[model samples]
Target: MSLVSQLKTLATRVGTEIKGLVRPDHPGLARAWVNFGYVGSAIQISSSHNVAGVARLAAGRYRVTFSTPFADTNYCWLAFARSNTNSNTQRMAIIRATTDTKTSAYVEVICATATGSLADTTEFNLMVFR
Candidate 1:
């Protein structure tokens, strides 16, 4: 092969590798994510990837199920939430529920008011990584 053709082939391969590394579907990146909230007392999933569904257990408590189960229960996760009116400060906790396996996560969203009680929010987001 000509030198120019060989260099072009090498450049294409390098570009493909870089793209794979940065793609959302990459094996080393996040496996699941969801943006959810309550709309008129019903759960609404605005957007998600690899998330099967979200269920509201009680006020400020929810369960997120993954479409594909992980190999084990060793994954890491992040959770965030905000108040409906955006007036109250919010704090969130991502937990492994007693019934959760490698395919689900449980989360709690609390509003930090003067009383410091657990309250539900308007929106919650979760991301899971393996």
Candidate 2:
């Protein structure tokens, strides 16, 4: 190939790599749930308490597989809802996993610090991706 053509090809290859690194692939959607009395309030990441759930998929009655990547140790990089449809009461936060495998996460719901509305119950659906 000529010099100009070679340069163009190199540029194209670099562009492709950059795009792949930056743009993540959407692995469709998946779901998880919390029980009625689960205290999913806030990202409780501490030496004493680390509140997080592993994203997983079940394979019949044999093996358990995690669709998303998760660490054995927990961190405080998740979000949760007070209820099913209370967007106003939902707590949003930026979660950063320890790895970049783009799989799995541990999320927590923000807690309410009050007398009447401190404790709550709810279930939530998580958008799973890789």
Q: Using lDDT, give the best candidate's number.
A: 1
* RMSD list, candidates in order: 5.2, 13.3
**Which residue pairs in model 1 clash with each other?**
none
The TM-score between candidate 2 and the true structure equals 0.24
lDDT tens readout by residue for model 1, 18-128: 987788766578798888886788889999988888887667667777887777767787877775665655456535456543443433333332355555666788888
Runs in model 1 with CA error above 4 Å?
1-17, 20-28, 94-116
**lDDT score, candidate 1, position 94:** 39
Q: How many residue pairs clash in each candidate?
A: 0, 8
lDDT of 2 by residue, 20-113 (tens): 7764342332333232223354322221122134322211000112334454423223333344344544422223324323324443332332
Per-candidate TM equals: 0.68, 0.24
Model 2, total clashes:
8
Model 1 vs. true fold: TM: 0.68
Worst 10-residue stretch by lDDT in candidate 1? 104-113
